[model samples]
Target: MNQEHDAGPGRSGVSRRNFLGGGLVAAAVTPLLTGQAEAKAAAAPTVDGVAQVTVRAAVNGSPVTVRVDPRATLLDTLRERLDLKGTKKGCDRGQCGACTVHVDGRRVLSCLTLAATTTGREVTTIEGLADGDRLHPMQQAFVEHDGLQCGFCTPGQIMSAVAMVDDEGGADSDDEIRERMSGNICRCSAYPRIVDAIRDAQQVMR
Candidate 1:
């Protein structure tokens, strides 16, 4: 005798094939849902319910007033908003001094500094180091000593070197220059020439 079997569903009111199909569908939909949520989150503007504010600051001896998000870094503000591209962004976490700039005549890591904090403060960038067609003393020294290899870190290195010479307890020797300027890392390993350049600039600056 032949027996008839119901292949549509089991006693649990669900078929094995249907169950697997539903599971696969759910798995695919989950990622889509998650991606949509992430996109929405990223598209949202306000940070912690605070909106962007207008910040007025002096950049390279020019007065600038710009609207920036509170969390925007000084590096981004300079490069993106103010159109100052000389300040290179290496390590945005402040580990590298490639984004160095002068804030009130003191060298500060622009990547780690907030744009809003620079309001009403004097900020100087690499472009400001030149007088008309003449390069700054430190910049001239860097070129003469071949202090840069790739030249990506040259701006920050020169900025720091200039500030170092102005400091009361700045580096007076090659070893001191290396130790003091250690925050700025040059992947090209141009330390020897960098030191030479800084020392030469120090005499010229003095």
Candidate 2:
């Protein structure tokens, strides 16, 4: 009787089956529980977080639609989303002119600009200024005059020059031109060539 009980038929197999069944039940239930949890999270209320706003602005001479974090600066949106990598981020603050772009034909520091606020305004960047292979006169002049070294600040410099030239900001004497354009600084100490480039380009534009 003891031997028969010790060799009990299919007892280990029955226990194994029970363990596997329990594991299967738990495995099936976990995903369902996770889905329920996610659904509950979805039902949670929205609160004080910043709202995303979609804006339409003329970027690189093309109309574009972008949805951006409301708090994101125009510079961040332009560089990150619009793929206008020419605008350098020298100082996130407005002190540096490296992030300048033509906003509605005027030079606006993109670093200080708000993307949502610039909707429907014409924003011109370095990439947009050229007509296909032909460079914008300022770009050509900058190259001819060697207006850059390291070239990190070249885009913003030229963009500012474009705005300056458009506004006849370069019409003044060299000192005044230098004074007005003084906001833009070149780390490479290329100011003299930059001024010459602007002067050279001014004559061509006139």
> TM-scores, in order shown?
0.76, 0.75
lDDT of each: 0.76, 0.71
Model 1 stretches astray by more than 4 angstroms: 1-49
In candidate 1, position 83 carries an lDDT of: 70
Residues 1-206 of candidate 2: C-alpha lDDT, one tens digit per residue: 11122322244666422443211111111121122343343221211233445567778777676554455588877776666789988977887699989988999898888887988899988888899999989999999999999898888898888888886456467787788788798888999999999999988876
**Model number with the top lDDT:** 1
Candidate 1 residue-wise lDDT, 1-206, digit = tens:
00012223447887534643311111111121122343343232332244545567888997776555576688877876667899999988899899999999999999989887987999999999999999999999999999999999999999888888875446767899899999899999999999999988898888
RMSD of 2: 18.4
Error of 2 at 83 (Å): 1.1
User: How many Å off is the CA of 94 in candidate 2?
Assistant: 1.2
Give the root-mean-square deviation of each candidate in angstroms. Answer: 16.5, 18.4
